[model samples]
Target: MLKQFGCTKFATGEDFDTGELFVQFEHRGRMVSLIASSKGYAAAWLKENPYNNRRKGTKADHEAKALEKGGTAVYSILRDWVKGQVTAIEIGMLSFESAFLSHILLPSGKRVIEHVEEQKLLEGK
Candidate 1:
């Protein structure tokens, strides 16, 4: 879907130590990156699935499995989300910038959302 809409390249990276994953793509001459944390998702999943007593695994092994599951879940979620946003852009429901503003890279070598975070732009008044 992304290639159909002016995305020329796509790549992915992962950090097992940090449980972070990122995907980078070129869209309409601009580089956009999206990031997710397997640890964060795993934490959330653990909250919902607190009881793993029936599972036979050491603590570290359980954590490792959880992180792996989280990574898979996050990937699926990101795929669906990107497809939806691309569809929205394709159908004229949104502009590319509006659809992916947060993921869009800026000249400052940071994502737009990073700048927004530095400035606390989303903070409540």
Candidate 2:
């Protein structure tokens, strides 16, 4: 049964030190909670790589190196999350990203996403 559901905006922007996004619900007479994006999840990532000099000095030198690091970071985070048995996730600013990443770490992609908003803003009101 559903008990609680909602996503809160970061109090101090992306400074994970402030807070995080998550959801809660009741399952089998117990409340299951999930916490996500509790830290600067994307700050260190998407940046330059300290290793792999060859990834640079190419056509997209700068961009390629950065993207490679991003991919590796994503893999690491996903793997860690799986090991920790976290029940929720937030990534790449999209629902599919969460589902796809979770699938890689969770069986059957056995994940469920519920998005809720008080007032969704749309173009032209």
Local distance difference test, each candidate: 0.87, 0.37
- For 49-93, candidate 1 gives per-residue lDDT tens digits of 664668777767777777889999989888898999989988999
Off by over 4 Å in 2: 1-59, 86-114, 117-125
Candidate 2 per-residue lDDT, tens place, 15-85, comes to 22443444433333333334455233433543333335555465456554555544455445544644343
User: Which residue pairs does candidate 2 place in steric collision?
Assistant: none
Highest-lDDT candidate = 1
Models 1 onward score TM values of 0.90, 0.30
For candidate 2, give the lDDT. Answer: 0.37
Q: RMSD of model 1, in Å?
A: 1.6
**Model 2 lDDT-worst window of ten:** 1-10
Return the lDDT, model 1, position 9.
99
